[model samples]
Target: MPLPELSISDWQDAMAREKWTSADLVEGFLAQIAALDSAGPCLRSVIEINPDAMQIAEALDQERQAGAVRGPLHGIPVIIKDSIDTADRMLTTAGSLALVGNHASQDATCVRRLREAGAVILAKSNMSEWGYMRSTRPCSGWSSRGGQTRNPHVLDRSPLGSSSGSAAATAANLCVASVGAEVDGSIVRPASANGIVGMKPTVGLISRYGIIGVAEPQDTAGPMARCVEDIATMMNALVGADPKDPTTSRCNARPMVNYRKMLRPDALAGARLGVARECFSGHEGTKGVIETAIRALRDLGADIVDPVQASELPFFGPMELELFQYGVRANINRYLSTHPGAQVRDFDELIEFNNRHAADVMPYFGQEFFELAREKGHWDDERCLHIQSELRRLARDDGIDKALEKHRLDAIIAPTEGSPAFAIDTVVGDHILPFGCSTPPAVAGYPHISVPAGFVNDLPVGLSFFGAADEDAKLIGYAFAFEQAVQARRAPRFLATKS
Candidate 1:
């Protein structure tokens, strides 16, 4: 069997049954990567294969030999996004050539947790250069360091990003599980594209101390997996408070651990679920699939409500999409400064770097947003504060909260993205319908999970489950039930012919 067809659970059970060793699994994935990466439809998802990956796997095998198991991820191979910091041999470039040979002095909070869980950091996956904020060129998995990552389903289609490679690789089964960060649609969009499960935990649920930041308010790390249970398995090991990130102090104040034990497939049997009508006016296929899901929820004994309204939305209108870019330029530059060997240390330096490498980096689009972010003022500025505040209130306090209150709902359901993979193009930016990752839980800093909804044209579509801030458990429970009920996940063929 191909390495790309195995799931996290598949590998875990194999290792426990002694059917396969950790070393064997790592070697299988690496061999599969070499066979399919540059040729065989060429889904160039991996940016850098960790030099010490096998060594780490050997150590995990030794521990297993000693009957010293860490957990479900005891010897699992995992992939990290380029934006994540890892104090290892792999470069943390955030997919930017500017940081081509950089190294992190420390691990990002989630990476540290993965290590503590005994998971091997398999490789650095490709990304939208600088988490897709480098330009508006619809880079989708294309990075100056690693070139474009094709959708495994259809070689010519786009694997929607920022976290494009992470989601694509997981769907292609390049790793057992993957960690991707979200500002807006980075995690969910690609998850939708790849027919997999993606969990964007509440912004502070998983610490962000060492992640390359985009928007502090919206930035978060999440688990990308083949199933909701796999997501839970990974998150159980990753979620916690880190003193390095003050945002995690909230979790420290509570001190809870092991979320998987709390999961129940029948958990949604008595929960309140809302349908956010405001988010789906134009997406007919998405609307149909979600309605089908709502019917299944009702069969599962859930109380469903329609037309839940979102309140106090931003006055910026469509300009709402660009708000996070300003946040990314400000925060990513600060983090890059701390990474030695990175070519660009600041936004000014990035623009200068792009200017110098225009032939390679700007072969498609200019750094328009980076220039605009350089012009924006401090966080306290009235303009920045007012819009960001409104974004949160609408997504959170007034919107999701209001719906939950009025309908007594426990969670909400919507489409994670407009549809499956579209044609990849550097000339045009994302062709997303206005209905995706727009409201629901994104702006609210709440928990949202996306799993395979269905397909349009052999391309995967995803359904999103959203709930209140800190309602991560319930949302996961609901998603797990839905995934079991629907069973829609399909492996990419990587066929000799494109769809």
Candidate 2:
């Protein structure tokens, strides 16, 4: 009953038979992680293995035997991005040395939901340093606490980030699924690079109570896994209202727990889909793959409109960065104030810590963004106050919302990232300019999901489907259908090992 290539639903169905149990799956995956992380390919995707993963899995199996099935996620083993708080044995460091010994005092709201749904938190995955804001020079997967997490497909290339290990671990089948949080390109970019499904749920859709700090306006935890079905299944557990953060409560219009049921094979059949011009302008290989994806949508009977133009405002670029910097200092400061045991107290203290431990903390890169952000005033400042409202208004109302209303479209399609992961460069920062698929949805705080479309020169590529706010299900449904129709996903071969 065990399928070595089992997905979330596939594994659940197989486990329904008495012959299959969570322990079997856990054992199989633990072996997989050991082989990949230690011996076979030597990936550092798993930052820390949960010592009690098997114990938790065995307990869940017993609960099921006692007629207490939790739901789709019951007994499913999933790794959490280092940024997500587990409130368990694993330290939630977000791949930073400063927080190495810190354990979350409480489970992040999203983590609690997964546990409530009976999913076993398997491990803590590696990530970009301080979720990629600390310094540009550090490699995407080379965190101070956990070294580089190589791409499962090709060891030398990137698996993308700041959710680097989440994408690699999920794509490599080290876990049944994993959760990845995004601030702009973190989830979608890595998903594209690793050939998995990366969903950036609408801002406030999932509670960020225990998640490590980032720019809240553009930050959200979503599913990063092998297929669209898995992403939807994980999302069902992750999305909800939380009292700790009023934003989740304010997202009254957010989708409730049934994302998987919304997947219709014909979801794209009559939908109006736009071809994002910006997403394809630069990279030839990526553009070709996206064009092919668009053609597939057209074959599915979608009306594909190319260059359905939307607003690109005067203050758009600077405003997004501005919001992120202001939000980072404010939110990280707030998180520190609440969680006092962490080594660093404020952004300034974090800077001091990095200076004190520069060899380990800033070995490869300096915190240019952090220094710049520290100079910016708090969210309450006049410039910060004026810009935050304007940024959200412009990104949401004048951007994605405007495009959808003007085109009368249900969704838009774009290359999830410009291309696949570039070679890891410790001295130089990320070369991520080609992302047409990320910006609007990321900036707007709307939902966007990327599914594996194909590969270019053996590296992964992705196609993104995004829509206006409260349309998480629509994007998921369309991406699922497209994935089904194409079946383009393939596990990374790393390299054909032949002497």
Candidate 3:
């Protein structure tokens, strides 16, 4: 039987009408993963499938039959990046072999929330080892535990990382939606490259309590799905203040609006959108696609601010790298220390473990970035503190804020990435074009979303919509409008290679 291209609401309606049970949904997805992920294309997107998923689905179905739906996400299947912790049988290794046997003592705040909302924890997706902070020339989805995750659109093309598997799986419809974490481009880039909807919510909006850390200041987990409505559906379950993560305290004070309700088809009618033209200077094919998308936005009533050059701001890249180094050393250690029974206790121990197991762990690339981070001082060191302050000021106040304030814009639009999926080259490493606009909003701790824009040579490209901190609702509205107007997303053909 051919399953429909079901959204969250569609799945809910199906269940409500007795067309499918939660167990049926889980089994269907599992079969797809076996056929598409494991044997057919060998996408290698999933690291570990939850052994208890079907049982959980059966229980959820029983509950639903008894007149109790947990919430909007009741019995929804969700794939989460491996970096996020779950207390279940799955290992939270972040794609590293060093932590192969490591298990979390309890569920990460995000997982707990998802479970409470009745989202079935389908599986853990592969990722760049340690969120791509291990080596300078790291391959996006090449992990020791789970090998390269191939893009479903073109089997040999790269699936952008560190959220590579999440994006790939979602685009392939292995699950209804997937959760991904991003420090810079992990979520958006992969979603853009794989042709899906990826949201990197404001850093504090989603709790980072159980997620493997890259940089606390910039790291966040959000939804990757086929449509903006599905992304919003996941966001509705993801948002809320968590006592475990202090950063979410501010979320409580803010107005709690249904993100799904904010999706207005006419949202772009009077909205001012700034085009980050500096980011538009990449592959001509990608540029042409994004240019067409921009024109479509204009045709749909958006007030387009063309050629906005916020990418020219100084001190953004250097400061961000410095902060990441410090964050890797400090934040990772903090997570390791809090979680007991871990094979490695600190970053230095991790380095030693990698060296000891170099044959399996460091087969292709060395941990040069980890070594560099190890040499960095504490997060509170005078130099580190100074860099953090300057990064926020430059990226937020002088960068995105300057552009937004000057144009009185509601959001900024750019190519989510410079180009479509590049060929995977293990020897020379990822040749992906460097046309990312994630740095500014990432450093600013703001929200950003990537919606499928169009195709470049049969490969997917994404259009980015970003906004000021805590303006997640507004950005969602704008992205929804654009997504509905453009209707650019196409189902993946699972080609053997780029045609």
Candidate 4:
């Protein structure tokens, strides 16, 4: 039988009914990957397929037959970004060649949680080299190890960076769901561009141990799937305190609740949504799409606060760079020192390695960001500390919190990205249109969700709903309500070019 859309619930129902075994499901996905990922459209999304996947699936099927089912995710296939460590046959390269032969000593905290929940580590998705922080003008989804990950909707258009492969694979139904890491637009923008649901939970909600570092202050791992329910299911497995990552300790004070319970179609009836007008001033097509979404929200009984002015936080832009530069240098050095079998021991070594292998690593774009990061002073420098503190104050105290308080809003809404997918330009680099809603929440380490809003031309765009810190469940409910009302997500046709 042909596979359905394969949401978490659908997959579970099929498995419970014995319509397909875990092995069968794994084989189906693997076949699809072979035909579509790097063969048909040359998506180049999956960097490495898990060689032990079949064995794991067979074991899960045997366990299920003996009535030892683990949970909703038992035997489900999940694609994880290459930046996340798996400790198995797959290598965690962060889509760079420098870390090619190194194997992780253990699974990342999130990966371990997924395993405990009975998820099959299906494959490793490609990502922007070093999470798109290596160059001044980086190409979205272009990685040294895996090449370019193309958007399924239009093969020529970009699958926006960093988490590009995860979003693309999920949108194309190559897997039931995928895990992605974010340090700003990495999760939401790609999810939006690829027409899928992406959630960036509060920074501490998911542990970062074993994942390649981008910035400690803002980096997080979250779920990317075709629907909010799948995202919630993945979230259920990923949240917990890990001794390896101290940030998780913050979550212990407020333990995680099942996010699936919060998905109510009537969730918007009494919700108040504030529109961040700043994020809407993008392409006219994108603006119109978001305007239609606003109308849908209003029709769904939501109180709409149009043109909410929340983007004027002081030092919002500059301080983000300051924190990222300092944090990446310090955090990566710490991670590299402890990571097993890593060839490049520090930022300086990584730079030298890239320079030596410039033919492969710097074929299209140079590592200017890495060079600049190396020049940054220590994380505890007076200026760095001040910028970090001020950024938090402005983004949280004076930005999202202030807006919500003034309007008595449940969440803030904005266009997840500016345009759908720009044409891939390898020579000059990605022509990223000035459109995204990742900054305020990212800098504040708050929760953010992106849902498919509508299409612009033949490409997909997303509507973002973000809330104050630790409000992930509520945001999920709000986004689910919006998703149900809009019913905007559509399967990609894999068009050869934009219509």
Candidate 5:
């Protein structure tokens, strides 16, 4: 039997009506992974499957029969990015071979929350090795251990990263939903390219304790799903404070939000949404799609503020890269210090490991970023501190804030990416286009979401909605409204390549 394109709510209803059990869903998805991921289109989205998934689902099924349901995600199967430590039979390698023998002593805070809320850890999705902190020129989805993840829409097209597998798997329905981490465009870009709903919530909204990362300040894991409602549901479970991660201290003071309640179809009515026109560069097809999206917003009773003063938004490319290098050295070393079982326990050892095993790990690209990070000074160094302060001031205050304040806008909207998926080019590395809106939200540590806008030459494009920090629920409401109005997303056809 073929699986329907069911949302989380649909699956809940089906289980409640006795149409299917959690085990049945798990078996079906496993079969699909075997057929589609490994055989049919060979998307390579999943790095590894959880051996205990079916058994866990069976246990959940037993609980359901006994009149016990954990919560909204009771028995839901969720694929998490490889970087998230699960302390299961699965290895938390971050799509790198150096940590192949490593295992987490305990679950990552997010994974622990998901499990406690009755979400089955389905699989570990592949990602860019070391979260793309290993190389300046690297393929977005081509990890040393997991190979390349292909776009389901057009096989040869890029899936975008470092959350490529999570987005691709969610779009291809390999799992009910997936969690992906991002410092920059990792989550939203892949979500946009795969034509799914992805939200990079306020950095502290989701704890970063157990997840691997390149940067501490900006790194966060968020939900990617077929619809905004599903994203909202996942957020409710994922958001919480962890003592190990000091960044989530802000969440402790606020009561937990019922994100699903924020999902009103008419949420866009009378909302002042500013268009970041400067981020609408590159492909005309993508611009055209976003244009139609803008009109749809207007039709839905949104007050469109076009050409917001975003051209003045500072681009912190060089400084951000420098900070990432410094952070990779600091954060990765800290993580490794805890995971003593790993072969390469420090940044210096990791660099040496790659040099010793260059044929497999460095076949496509060298670890210049790793080398750079190793040579960088401490995070508290004068230059690093200056970089952090400037990033926040420019990206947060002078950037997104300037536009919203100037236009009296509720949120800012733009093309999530400059173009649709480009052809996957391993030799020359990722051809990521300019004019993406991910940088501001990423650096500001604010909330940002991407909803499928429409197709550009049969490949998907996404519209982004972002604003001030801690306004995640509001942004979700806007994206949900837009999503319900246009309903632009369609399932990928699994074409070998764009015609």
Candidate 6:
């Protein structure tokens, strides 16, 4: 069998058994992309396919034949969000038309690691324009260049933003796995909606070099896959230090551990899990599913701490917005000036370009956020620094850290998102619901993982496991145990819409 119905281990076993080569696996996925992504469902998940994917895969197959396997991800096909730089033929536009001609001179640090592990960079997945930092009321997955990426589970529903394509493609089996970035709900929300596993590792666990940034404080790229085991395997490949990103220095200080070895089916036993009840407010169906998930955890020997005030601190949204505005103005300008292949050089020029081509770029919504970024003051302004420091303190020391310490918990659990994928509405923008758990871990720069918990009327809801900084391995173990117990994930049928 090809990779369409196989996990990473299964595919490796198949290849070892000589059932198929890496080249054959790539061809199977390319066929699936053509059949489902471009024609059948027209999910628009992949923005662009790497033309040299087959050649890369064939070379990896040759390596395997010569007894030169690199790692667990050897010959595995992977897709990365368009925001990541590949230093290849594909454009890194972050789903915006303004940077349509831009290309990277070198791979993102994470991409380099994946390549070193012998993974094929199969495609660049579509994302929210500028990772949803373009407009105030922008549609989640709508991009001028790649168009809107619809939910694989339900075609008319939203796939969430930024990491939308990564999750959607993974759920639809377009690739073995995909990498997605998250400043907030981008990774997990889409994964929840698409019924896959998405992980947002502690910021600095993976290098951010060559990725288009929103805010350095919250931005991090992570693995999204059909199983938590695959995510752990990818984590082993992705975690590393890079001099280009100073935040990554923290990772170098810590001793490395094999994440895949951390996965245990009985990891949940004797673990104390706290539930942030705040996230249980929205969507009665989702709440019911989370309740069932909690029961399952209990049955599996976990001590559940009901109603933990982990996210009691507020004002993070506004504070983060201020930081994003400052960071975007600084980060994008720095990126454009340094990247020789960039079409637009600065935020002002990008705005001018968008205005000039509004019919194409802003047909659905205006670039208010872009305009806001351009108008922000210098990055080192006292007010900006104050907000930045206060945000970290509140979100870290007073928020997640406090909760973990007070309850003596291994990790906090909650619904990954407020509800299932909302309607894909460009005219009215995204119907963002309330009571999400992404912000706490996002702002804390802590590790968070979303595992498919259960379904709500056929729409998938995820159980989020998040905790203190550098607790990624523990959270993954917990998530893996929960995943094995619940077995909530299933391949999407590409239903036209909800009746």
Best by lDDT: 5
Model 5: how far residue 404 lies from native, Å? 1.4
lDDT to native, each model: 0.79, 0.82, 0.88, 0.89, 0.91, 0.89
Q: Least lDDT summed over 10 consecutive residues: which range in candidate 1?
A: 310-319
The lowest-lDDT stretch of 10 consecutive residues in candidate 6 is 310-319
Q: lDDT by residue for model 1 over 29-120, one digit each (tens)?
A: 89878877756668999888999999999999999989998878988989999999999888888777777778888899899999988899
Root-mean-square deviation of every model: 2.1, 2.3, 1.4, 1.5, 1.1, 1.2
What TM-score does prediction 4 earn?
A: 0.98
Give TM-scores for every candidate, taking all chains together and pairing residue i with residue i: 0.95, 0.95, 0.98, 0.98, 0.99, 0.98
Summarize candidate 3's per-residue lDDT along 137-238 as a digit string, tens digits: 888888989988999999889998799999999998899999999998899999999999999999888999989988888889999999999988888889
The alpha-carbon deviation from the true structure for residue 400 of candidate 5, after best TM-score superposition, in angstroms, is 1.1
Candidate 6, overall lDDT? 0.89
* lDDT by residue (tens digit), candidate 4, 274-299: 99987765598898999999999989
Runs off by more than 4 Å, candidate 4: 313-316
Candidate 3: global Cα-lDDT?
A: 0.88
Which lDDT value does model 1 have at 223? 96
> How does residue 357 of candidate 5 score in lDDT?
95
Candidate 1 collision pairs: none
For TM-score, candidate 2 versus 5, the one ahead is 5
Cα shift from native, residue 229, model 5 (Å): 0.3
Clashing pairs in 2: 153-494
Q: Global lDDT for candidate 5? A: 0.91
